[model samples]
Structure formats: structure tokens, C-alpha cells
Target: MVEALLEARNVVKQYGTVRALQGTDFSAYAGTVTALIGDNGAGKSTLVKCLSGVAMPDGGEIFLDGQRILLDSPTSAQRLGIETVYQDLALAYDLDAAANLYLGRELRRPGLLGMLGVLDKAAMRNGGAGALANLGVRLPAADAPVGSLSGGQRQSIAVARAVAWASRVIFMDEPTAALGVVQRERVLEVIRRVRDSGVAVVLISHNMPEVLAVADRIEVLRLGRRVARFAAGDVDVEDLVGAMTGALEASALGANDVEANDVEAGAQTGGEGNTNGGNGR
Candidate 1:
């Protein structure tokens, strides 16, 4: 496999009374949707916070293109070309799509007006509109307040904004949650579009079918640890549910254990069990 675009190794995070992450390891590859799934309280949220620089991990190494780096704040992550769309959407309710897109990184007029805090609305609007159109997201209008848009449209804005500025990775937290079936499908299509554009995507979702349908690979977290990583096409919903419920430890494999077992099984079975070899189940 190619080196991961973003990686977290042996990451640990803890609150005073709760240990949120326990030596967790995660990675995102360019042009793939890596779905992170786990039961509630399984530390998915904690891991996301750490990865997006919303919170600092107590200990661990985070790497970008194999180089260790620090992500102490959301701004830090953004500067590194990592953007996160939180579950809350994180937009100003009254702001238009373009305004929300350029919330903190707004364009200003040249020279004196720029120094006087004059924003270049036309430039920002054009940029935001272009981004949305490029991503194939349909919205009523780019200048309409986000609060006035439908659930899917609002989600699309959030995703489009992330895609516009994100050059390396995008973290999406339950992007289709609480939406209608159509809206969910639209969001899924947008996710595929993003991945196809060659940006690494880390999706945190509880929807099993969505994960199975959209993810290239799936990582399951159990009790603050990554218990299994599976190639999406190699596993079924039953397998995923089993891993989540602790009913199928046989299929749960770490990076090294997977290869080791495949080799052992191949030797024992005269290479017949090797059919699924290299599938990374």
C-alpha cells in the first residue's frame, strides 16, 4: 500500500475521569474513503477531535506524508490542508453560503480599503459559487442564508467549503445524519466526488449500510481501540455488526496479524485459503 496521506500512531487521549483513546492508530489514503465506525462511547469522537486539532491528544505521533507534525488547533489543521466538517455543521446560521465559506478567511479589497476592513463580496461569492458548481452540488442560491436551505443543501455547503480549501484531507462527521433518503444519497454522491478528486476522506458514520456502500476500507473501534480494519468489498454488514458487538473476533485483525495469519493459513491449506489473501480483511 502507498504511504498514508495522514496517519495517527499509538494516539492516546484521556479526560480526568474517562480514557477516550487507548493507543489508537488510524490513517487516510489519498483518493479513498476510509470509514471509521464503532459503537457509542467507542472513542470515535475523541479520535476525530484529536485528528482535526479540536483537541489535543495526551500522547501519540501524528504524521503527514510520513513527517511528524503538530496539530494543536483547528487553524493548525487547516493550515496543513486538513479540513473537518463537524456534526453541528459549524456555520453562522444567518450567514449566506458564500459568507459561511469565507467566514474567517475572507477576501478584502486592495490597498486602503483592505486596511479599512472592506471585504470583496463579489470575489468571495464567485469563488464559493465556483467551488459548489465544480463539486456538482446544487443549491438554491449561493447568497441565500444557510439556515434557509434544506438539510442536504446545508450539508453540501459544508462539504463544498471543506473541499474548496482542503488539499490533503477532509474529515466528515455523520454528514448524512437526520436527513431524508434523497438527501442522504446526495451527500453520499458528494463524498464520492470528493474522493474521486484525489483528496483523502475520513468519514465517521454510524450508518452501517452507508459505510458498506461508500467506504473503500472500514476501521472498527471497540472500547477505544481499533479492533479491525477491513476492505469494504470483502466484508458484509453481518461481519461489521459482529465486530462491533464482539461476536466475531476471528475476523478482527491488526496490520501485522492480518499478514501473519494469511501466511499461516496459506501454508496449512496448501494455498487454497489464500483466495482472500491481500484483501486486507
Candidate 2:
């Protein structure tokens, strides 16, 4: 309703003989968690790659703030305020939490030393500390090596890093996949905080309850296409499972159940499809 902060129009991707995506149109808005849910092999990973600049779609367009743009590389996407936290967390094990946060974008010392590429360890450490605090995430210490942190703590650092730098959108790919129940809840809270801070959060997950609990809107991807969209409040877990499996009929929930105008947009792009249970990831 606020106008899509990010949208993919008729996006397509392929892998040799496999058509990973069939003109999938996806959209996300500011200050909301838009869940991308599907069985494995639903092209969720492919779509994530495309949206995050890890891979280009074989065809289609991606728009940000109503302006069409190209995400040719990860840096390009980052420059455009798009950041992704993959399931892997991608942290530097040997480096401290603060160091991981400032991995490639470390702050520099003042004046000539700064010009000489001298690392500003103190500044980074303090900034990391503040950022974590701002996100309500408690860790052992910013100076603690990431490898020494718990799974939830590491995931928190990853989310905190993204939240600190993400100006527009953040893509979270199965962020709660490997966590314990408590850790999962912790990350979910961090995600809610990110959404509350006005960042467009795209959450990809297989856990229906978690998706329903945290997402503002849910987009069901079946095979390589989007089959349905649901307002988080309008549909229950049964409805989502039905939609994902094509058992409830595509667009069965109808657009009236949602507040956004584009709720039915995916129906126009969906078609015959197949997705391996949960094996695609």
C-alpha cells in the first residue's frame, strides 16, 4: 500500500534444462515483513540470488522506489541499499563480532593514517556495540570472536550488521533454519525490530508458524512461480499449506482478504508447477 520499496517484474531464471523461475513477480513494501514461503525447489533460492545480486535473472526487471535498476553484483545491490543474510550467516570465524560487522567496510583512522588505510579498531568496536544495543541484541561483547558466540548470537550479529547498513531492504533467507526454539524466537524478535525500523524485510522460510507469526504478508511460491498471496491476519496455517500445495486452488483466498492492491498480482504470473518437498534449499 505504501508503494513497493522493491519489486520484481516477470523475473525469469534457468539452470540448463530446468526453468527455475517462470516470470515470477514479487514485491515488498517499507516497514513490513513480506514472507516468501515455499517447498524446497520452489525457486526461492534462485529468486533470492536474483534479488540480492548474487545471480542475475535470465530475463525480467527489478525496480526499487519505482525506478527500474540493475543488480549486477552484490556490491551493486549493497550500494542500492539491498542486503541479504543467508542461512550460512557468512561471518568471519576468526574475527571478533565487531570485526565481522566491519569486514570489508571498516572505518579508517583520522587524517593521513586514515588515508593510509589504517584500521580504526576502536571506532568499529564501539559502533558495533552501539548498533547491537540499538537492535536490543545482547552478545558477550563486540570484541568477542564470532566463532566463540552462540548460534543465536551469531545470527543476531548478522541481522544487526544488515540492519545497521540497510537503507531500503534486507533479504533474510531461512534465517531461523538451524536454530533452537529459543534462538529462533530471538532471531524472530530481531526481525520484528528490523521491520519496525522502517526497513522492507523479505523473509524466506519453510516454517509456517514462524512465517505466520512474523510476516505482515505472505507470498506463496510453488515450483518457480508465485501462486498466491495472503494477509498475515486473513489466513491460517491450513490456508498457507493448502496454497503452497495447490490443494486450495490458486488465489482461493481472494484479494479482498488483503489490504494491498497487488495481492492478486501473482495469480496472473502463476501456472502449472512442481516443488520438491523441502529439499530445494
Candidate 3:
């Protein structure tokens, strides 16, 4: 069997009396979009944080390319070709799109001017434009400040930045949370382009229609662990909701069987997973 490009096994996370993740397992393959969906307190955000290196798991292992790896910090994850686009779409409102794309990884000029920390603005502008263009994102003005752009454009810039740097896996949390129909479709197009580039795209979303529209595979989380897995073509919104709420029997789903321990752990939590740790989904 081909190993997943990224995988998590028996992952656990705790927040002082509340367990956010209880031996959760996850996997993402290259050249595919894997949707991670769950209800509000299902530990989606916590798992993303652990995988993206924002926080360390209290227990369990994470693997990249089938090799066990440690993600101690966000920078460490970035070095390993892992990037995340959070819902807030962290961008400098005062800076132009080009500047925001190269916010931290700025290109520098060669020679003494480079030594003096001079940024290659023109190169970045051209490169940023190219990157956005490659993803089918068209801005009204390349030089326009991100603050002045529409919500969709800003979201696209955030995705573009992640795509420009990510070579292995990209985790997008709620990429299309709030947007008009056109903008949402545009961002979904960019996601398709990224997936086609052979990078594993792990999408965290609550929009069932959007998830079914874009995801090749779907993993359902309940409480803090995976309850079901399905090929997007095999399930509908009802199935997804059933998995998330534990309304349907895991064994009857004909998907991956839910582990017994995970179900028990979830029961022990009494649905307090989201509130105790400030680990809101």
C-alpha cells in the first residue's frame, strides 16, 4: 500500500482537565484534497494545530512521507514544506498584496544593498503576481493594500501565499467561511489547482456542500476522534452529519470502523471537548 504523504496516529491533546483530542488518527495523500469535517466541538482546530505545529500533541505520533517526525514549532513545520491558512487570513492590511505574499520570506537584493536589508520589491511584485495568476486569482490592482480589497480577494491572497511556499502539504481552515457565491467558487478553484500540483491539501470545513464539491476523501471527527471515513463520491450531507453527531452506527457506515477506545473516550468527556481548553472549532 502506498503510504500517506502526511499521517497522524493515536494523537492526543489535553487542556487542564479537558481532552481536545483522544487518540485521533488522520491521513492526507499527495495530489488529493482531504476534507476534515466535524461539529463545533469535534477537535478539528486542535488537530490542525497539532499537525501544523502550532501546538504539540500530548501523546501520539505524526508522520511525513511515512517517516516519524516532530513538529516543535510553526517554523519547523514550514521548513518541512507544511503551511497553514487560518480563518483570520493573517495579512498586513497596510501592505499591498505583493508585500503580504512575501511578508516573512522576502526576497533581498544582491550585494551591499542586500546586506543593508533592502527588499527587492519589484521582484516580489512580479513573483506575487505570477503566483496569483497561476492560481487563477485576479486582483483589481496588484499594488492595492490588502485592507482595501474585498474579503474574497484577501482570502485568495492568503491561499496564494501558502501555495507559493508549500511543496508538500497545506492545511486550510474554513477557507470559504464567509463569502458570496462567486468568491467562494474562485477560492475553491484555487484549491483544485493546488491539489493538481501534487500537494496534499487538508481542508477543514463545516460546509457540507462545499466539502462534497471539492474533497476527494472525507474524514469525520466526533468529540475528538475520527468516527468515519468516506470517499466524497460515496456519501451525502446526511451521512456526514450522522458521523459527526454519532447518530449513525460506525460499523454500519461501510467506511473505516471507528476505534472502540475513541468512542469510549468521547463518552467520558461528556461533550466538554470544546469548552474546557478554549479549543473552539
Candidate 4:
């Protein structure tokens, strides 16, 4: 089996009296779309934050390419080729597409101008346009402000920025949310292209059909811990819902049937006692 490009083992995170991640384990392979699914308050966001280095885990370990690593900040994660496209898109509404793409990491003019902090606008614009084109993203105009673009176009720009910088993995939180059908499909196509380019895409979304449609693997989280893992082709919406809601143990399908369907619903235990269902190999 291929070693996971990114892996989190027994991760734990707490906020005051609330425990956000309870020994949750996650893995994302290179060149695959792994969907992280759960209901609200299921710790999906908490885990993502930890994995993306926006937040630190209270305990447990994270590995990149089989070596343990510490992510002290978002910059640290980015330095190691990890990027996140948040649900908010986080693009500057007033900035044009190219500017937003290189918002924090702007290219500089050469020699004295670069030393004087003069940005190479033309270089940035050409680079951003090429990145978007490689992802098959279409914008109405190369110089248009991101705010002027459609929801999908904006989302695509955010994704393109992440993909342009991320050499290993990209965490996309609801890339298709609030988008029109055409826009959503366009974003999904970009996701497929990214995966095909050999970058691990960890997708977090509540839309079941969309998850099933794009995810190569699925991991279901409930009450701050992962309760099931499945190959996307091996499960349907019902199975995914059952796993997220803990209905797999109570539903008529029963344990044997779940096994038959190749679902590894975690042990019927609580808290840290719950184990990962199975590796979505």
C-alpha cells in the first residue's frame, strides 16, 4: 500500500470544557480525493484546523511522508506544501484575481526595484493566469476584481492559489457550497484535475451526493472522533449517513451486513475508546 502523504493519528483538541477532537485519525493519499464528512459539531472543522496548522492539537501526532512533523503556524504548513482553501474563500474583495492569488506572497520587481519592495505586477498576473488555466478555471477577465466574479469563479481562484503553492496536499472546506449547479460542477472538475495531478485533496463537505460524486475515499466523523471509513465506491448516501449518525449499529443492516458492504464502522464504544473503522484502501 502507498504510504499516506499526510496522516493524523489519535489527534486530540480541546476548547475550555469542550473536547473538539477525541483521538480522531485521518489519512490522505497522494493523487486522491478523500472526503471528511460529519454533521455539525462533529469536530471536522477542529481536525482540519489542526491538520492545516491554523490550530494546534493538544496531543497526538501528525506525519508527512512518514516523518513526524510539527506545524507551528499556517506559514509552517505552507512551507511544507500544505494549503487550505477555506469555505469563506478568503479572497480580498477589492483585489483583482492576480493580486488575490499572490496576496501574501507577491512577486517583486528585479534588482533595485525589488529591494525597494516594488511588486512585479506583470509577472504575478501572468503566473496567476497560467495557474488558473492549468486548473481549467475560467474567469471573465484576467484583471477583474475577485468580488466581481461569480461564486464559482471566486472559489476557483481560491483553489488555484492553494494548488499553485501546495505541492503535497490541499484541504478544501466546502468548495462548492452556496454555488450554482454549473459553478459547483466547475469546482468539482478543478478538484478532479488537482487529484489527477497527484496532489492529495482532502475535501470537507456536508453534501452527500457531491461527496460521493468526487471523493475517492470517505471518512465519517461523529462526536469528535472518526467512526467509519469506506472506499467511496463501496458506500452510498445511506451508509455514509448511518456512519455519521451512529445508525450503522442500530439500523436493520446489522453488523454482518455492514461488513458485507465493506464498511468498517468503528467499535460500539465511546470517547477515546472508539477506534478507526478501517483503512479506506
The lDDT for every candidate, in the order shown, is: 0.81, 0.83, 0.85, 0.84
- Give each model a TM-score: 0.87, 0.89, 0.89, 0.89
Top candidate (lDDT): 3
Task: Name model 3 segments beyond 4 Å from true.
Answer: 255-281
Per-residue accuracy of model 2 over 38-155 as CA lDDT, tens digit each: 8888899899898999887877778899998888888899999999987899899889988988877999999999999999999998999998887677786667788998877888
lDDT tens per residue, model 3, 1-281: 45789998778898898888987878899999999999998999999999999998877778899888889888899999999998899899999999999988899999999899999999999999998898788899889899999888898899889989999999999989867898889889888988999999999998999999999989888888877778888788998998899888765675533333333333443433323322222
State residue 86's C-alpha deviation in candidate 1, in Å: 0.6
Model 1 residue pairs with clashes: none
Which stretches of model 4 miss by more than 4 angstroms? 250-281
Cα lDDT over the full model 1: 0.81
Give a tens-digit lDDT track for model 4, residues 1-281: 68899998878787898988877878899999999999999999999998989998877788999988888688999989999999888899889999999988999999999999999999999999999998777687899888998877888899889989989999999988867888788889888988998999999999999999999988888888877777888788998898788777533434424233423344234435224312111
Ranking of candidates on lDDT, top first: 3, 4, 2, 1
